[model samples]
Target chain A: MTRILAVGRYSDVDAAALAAMGAQALPSAAALAALPAALRAEVHGVAFMGHESFGAAEMDLLPALRVIANFGVGYDNIDVGAATARKVLVTNTPEVLSDDVADLAVGMLIAQSRGFEAGIASVRSGDWQRRGPLPLARRVTGRRVGILGLGRIGREIADRLAGFRCQIHYCARTPRQTPGWTRHGDPLSLARAVDDLVVAVVGGEETRGLVSAEVIAALGPDGVLVNIARGSVVDEPALIAALEQGRLRGAALDVFWNEPAVDPRLAALPNLLPLPHVGSATVESRAAMGELQRRNLSAVLAGQAAVTPINAP
Target chain B: MTRILAVGRYSDVDAAALAAMGAQALPSAAALAALPAALRAEVHGVAFMGHESFGAAEMDLLPALRVIANFGVGYDNIDVGAATARKVLVTNTPEVLSDDVADLAVGMLIAQSRGFEAGIASVRSGDWQRRGPLPLARRVTGRRVGILGLGRIGREIADRLAGFRCQIHYCARTPRQTPGWTRHGDPLSLARAVDDLVVAVVGGEETRGLVSAEVIAALGPDGVLVNIARGSVVDEPALIAALEQGRLRGAALDVFWNEPAVDPRLAALPNLLPLPHVGSATVESRAAMGELQRRNLSAVLAGQAAVTPINAP
Candidate 1:
């Protein structure tokens, strides 16, 4: 039987299902760390959760490995260069997560702008019994939305926000004509022109520090910052400075710099709303991503190019 | 000059505007409390905030007082009986707040369903260093939505949800045929049939105890509740019980039993998301309501029926 080492922590697919397709599924993280030398030498492929970086030691074991299927859409954790040098194929579940992340960003904006969370907290705290005047709502409709890296996900966010009547603008590496969106040359320029700036770009060396303090400072206090992309894209220190100084009205983020161990400085600020990075956490979207990954794995093992391969690797 | 005891706080249309119309404005809350007997006898009308309940003492202000303009769509706060007994014309701002409230409810539904608050909290806390799995969203497009009442605001809520392609059912005093939405005979039947219940019933004695524990239990866990109507319409204790026990998946409430004091039970619960009643908090909506009240006050003082008279009180 063709053996496959699936390294991810969370997978919706059954092992028996993978076996049915003429492959063995090995997903225990502990097992991946302690594979017998003999067995490790025989493993022909590796699959893992879309969470983090795959180290060199694990890569050294799959001498005959030809394909790597990431469980989630992002592949920053995987060493694409090592895979490329070894002629390995890499695939990720893309568009499957677009709508869910878009949905999340839109929801965050609504909750923050309307003061829904704080209002809820106030009521829950018993401070609302006296029926004081209603705290105001920040107008969301007709506000300008500036998107960084208007790729597939960015475009989807734009499409969803279109329903709310916001004008859309985007900053990208190059200009492209999207029906309702106007294009700005890059991040700082885009931030200057809009009421809200959303970061939906990818994570990698090229994008590591793209959204620095300069960009955030340019966005200013009246501007709302939303990051649904990666923490690496933003300079955490700059974001904290902007938030502490009240240079930004509010921030809604789905990812953070040094996450899980989140910057403690950010944890203390009330202006920023944090989430435990669940952009594609919806039941429908996760299932769809898993199914898509499975299809890619099956196709690649069957000697076909993956349905959605990371072009660089 | 026409003497008018303007009981409500004025917007941009200040004393100057009223002065131009041959009316002198009283600016004190205490002045409102101690109306001069002679001035009270001379006043031809009164204008008030939506929050004020004109009690018997205030109602006995003037025999010449022909009209009262309420600065909100809801006249529930106004003691219409007292006004009616004195043959005073009472006009309320309506229709203006309908779309705004409906929009807010939908926004709340989307926020809670998508875990926007959680996402924001994660971002704010700096725990979002890496993108984690997102909670998959329940299919909002086709879920069953049960409305508590078939009044104007409820009807407007139905109108917006229609575009999402969901099945609509509502509980009302009597059944009425609208182009869309199926009317249920009562709350229990509607709760039993639908997946999401939206509260939009009127306030006060008749509908105060409407949504009981039994009705909420019938909705079941995974069933969501959204209340944009008066807080009394929902049995707060019952609803909180449902939320705590996981009998209901989530709830989005704007109104509370007490105005400024949020219920401690609700604030403590994570499943229930409360909003300080921002229904009709939009600038556009508020401005429109004010304009309508101004027009009504003008027309009534000119010896014409106000645009919207609630039982001539």
Candidate 2:
């Protein structure tokens, strides 16, 4: 019997791993719902990936679902409240991808400040030869940097920035022991205190629109914003307005409100260094995520505790 | 009488600075040579910028030229040997731009590994909406990184890479107090020992073609090459061929052989991330470099020691 259902687009390595575990593959959640009710009853576990909403409605469809193992660290798409209500264990692969995410966050920050988008374009368009150097970009080293949330991934970003001689300031709900880093009371204070703000908080309702208009204003016109966190954390409309009006210096984003479908206005901004949500989308990281996800699924389905459970349901 | 001549393209800030010092601005080295011998003999110092050759012939024209204050760290363009022989002091702005150069070096390394060129293109071309996430990029953190020179700039690059958790290896002619960093005897061994090689050696006759074909071959297909040092340091023809045949993974270059006119073949490579020699081109760094250059000129013309002299006469 096919006890596990692997959903969303996966790498060949991940697909092979799933196949070896006798897991049935589905393109998406909608596809899984289209299956006959009798067929859905046999799925005891799910190894999920992607940004599609996996809510109570989807959870109810899999009556025998014992666990949902998310492929990546951020599990905002998976409603943990719904999973808990349904008595389904929720697990996420974390720590494994912190380095890759942090690496990209730092990369985006430097790319935006250094005018890499324009620099790369100038070189490729043969403008460097004809037009000379791009306008002088801002210096990255020794700048004041603020992390929105100093979680595992945020700390990693801060740690990397520290090497560049950047002054690290952060805000977190429950403060961790961060020596040599200044901790702020809230997002607004954090934004006001730094030259650049990097959003590294969690996703979901609590954090939705956490980086509000006030926060953006506090960051000021000379401040750059880097969002490797969920798009929901930032008020996208305010960000767009600020960027359009030059009220913000620039932005380097890896995620968006409607990702894979970014706003054309945001996409057209000359100062932006936009990337597809590729924070943890590295060959090594994805493989580790897949392995962790499989382990969680296998453990939960065998009547043992999930390896990295988010909810003890 | 104007005792100083400022050459090459300078920022508005630098131009203002030179003007305040009663320095006459000429366009290039050729322009300086073309000046009337009477006027040229009035110039005691040259605040030089750009990549033009300043050899014995040019030195002979300015009988009163006591100091050549190069406006950047590398004085390769200025013939230091010629200056030494002529009893003309050669001073360069060394430490001022190390952070900027190191920042760009690290940025290029991450951008190349994380496919920032393709990723940026995907976002701009609306390919994310049309297609999907780009193929997973290689992870940057924890990779083995080799520095070809452990000079001030090389040390800065290694220090930044250290925060990324990279295993740092380096090859330096004179070993410094590098505690955790593994040292190699030469470039070939350094390239062979690491997954990525960054060329940070000085540029001139001795160090030209330091990253030779054999060195590139040793780095192999999975290794990346990042050159922020100089165009002359790497063998361009060999590098172009290796990139063409997939003998190396990729290269991120700031300087190129015969730059401002890069080889069309090298520029067209999908795996290459090319820049217009912007290692120390940040506004802050450039201002600092210009100020340093002026100080050197001012001191030397005032019958004092050059502030940061490369060749004392």
Candidate 3:
């Protein structure tokens, strides 16, 4: 009997890992809904991946669902409130992927500041020899940098930036004990205080559009924005306008409102460095995430608590 | 009287700064040689830039040249031995640009490891929509990283990587007081011990081809090579062969054997991230370098000591 349904796209390694645990694979939440009623009734937990929504309607399909083990740090797609209401535990793999996410965030910041895209293009097209030195890029070291959120991933990014000698400023509802780091009450104040702002906030209705137009403008014409958080956290149109009007210097984005199919305007900007949402996308991190997800599934299926539960349910 | 002749390329800001110091600008060493004997005789110092050879022949042309104020950290092109023999002091802008060089070095490491080139390409070409997530990149954080030469720039790179939780190992002729960092006696030992090797040795005859084929081989198929020091420090042909044969995973190069005109073979390799010698190429660092170069020029022209002399003559 299939005790677990591994939903969403899974790598071959992840699929094999799931199969070993008596779990059957489904391509997505839609696929899980299409499963025969008998099989759906047998599934006690879900090892979920991807950014597809899994709300109350999907929960009703699996009467025996005890837990949803999310394969990523962000659980915005899982509708935690609905899971809580239905008495189905929602667990997410965090901390394990923080290093990978922070690494990309810092990498993107440096890449944009140093104009890596133009530099690579010049070398590939033989333009370096033809045109001599590229226009000098801005220095990244010792600059003032702001973090939009001071969560697990945000703290990691700040810690890494400290090595670069950056003056770290962050915005959070309540200040934490981060010595040598300046704390701000709001995003606008934080953005105003720094030359670069990296979005590391959570993704959900409460935090949606947290990096609004005012925050972007406060960052000013010399400021750079790096978003490693959810796409909805930043106002895409405002960001687009800021770049288009030279109200902002540049941006490096790994996520977008419509990812995989990013807006053409954002993609066409010469000053923007666009990356396909690759945060937490590394062989090592993925393996760890899968292991954590499976552990959550195993614990919950055995009538115990989920390993990294989001709610008591 | 033109007390200082600013040789090689100069940005407008640098040229103006040079002019303020009662200096005249020449396009290159060739241009300096083309100057009339009377004009060359009046030049007390040469504020030099670029990678052109400046040996005894060029030194002989400027009979009254008291010092060469190089506008970059690397003074390899100045032929310091010849300067010493001729009783002409050689000064280079060093510490002022270390941060920028280190920044680019670390940036390139992360960029190459994360496959920034391919990620940017996929987004620009709209292949991200056509395709799904990119193949997982190797984790950069907490990896064993080796610095080939523990110089000022190399030390800076190691310091930054420490924040990423990297286990730092370095190769230096004589060990310094760097606690917690593993020091190796030779490049081969360093390569054998680490997953990544960053070349940060000085350039010139003594250090030419320091990262030879043997060293590249020891780094192995999973190893990455990052060269930010000088083109002469690494064996270009060996690097190309290693990448071509899959003997090494990848490389990120800021300097090349014949820069501006980088070898097409290296450029063609999918595994290599080739930059056009942009180690210290930033607006802030260049400005700082120019100021330091001028300070060296001014002091030398005034019959005092060169501020940052490579050789006292």
TM-score of candidate 2 relative to the true fold = 0.99
Kindly provide the TM-score of model 1 when superposed on the true structure, using C-alpha atoms.
0.83
Task: Sort all candidates by DockQ, best to worst.
Answer: 3, 2, 1
Query: Candidate 1 falls in which docking quality class?
Result: acceptable
Q: CA lDDT of each candidate?
A: 0.75, 0.92, 0.90
User: Which candidate gets the maximum lDDT versus the true structure?
Assistant: 2
* Candidate 3 lDDT by residue in tens digits, A1-313: 5478889889999999999998888898987667899989988889999898999899999988889999998988887888888889999999999998899999998989998888888898899999888999998999999999999999999999999999999999999889679999988899989999999999989889889999999999999999999999999999999999999999999999988889999999999999988888888999999999999998888877778989986
How many residue-pair clashes does candidate 1 contain? 39
How is the predicted docking of candidate 2 categorized under the CAPRI scheme? Answer: high
Q: Taking the tens digit of each residue's C-alpha lDDT, what string does model 3 give over B108-168?
A: 8888888889999899889998977789887899989999889899999999999999999
User: Which regions of candidate 2 deviate over 4 angstroms?
Assistant: none
| Separate clash counts for every candidate | 39, 0, 0
| Model 2: DockQ score | 0.86
- Candidate 2 Cα deviation (angstroms), residue B277: 0.8
The lDDT of model 2 is 0.92
Which residue ranges in model 1 land beyond 4 Å of their true spot?
A11-34, A55-58, A130-135, A149-152, A171-179, A212-218, B6-34, B50-52, B55-57, B81-85, B95-100, B116-142, B147-193, B201-215, B261-263, B282-313
Question: What would the per-residue lDDT of candidate 2 be over residues B1-313, giving only the tens digit for each residue?
Answer: 7488888888888999998999888989898767888898898888899998999989999987899999999988888888988899999999999999999999999999999989988988899999998999999999999999999999999999999999999999877888589999989999989999999999998899999999999999999999999999999999999999999999999999898889998889999999888899888999899989999998888888888999766
**What is the C-alpha DockQ of each candidate?**
0.42, 0.86, 0.86
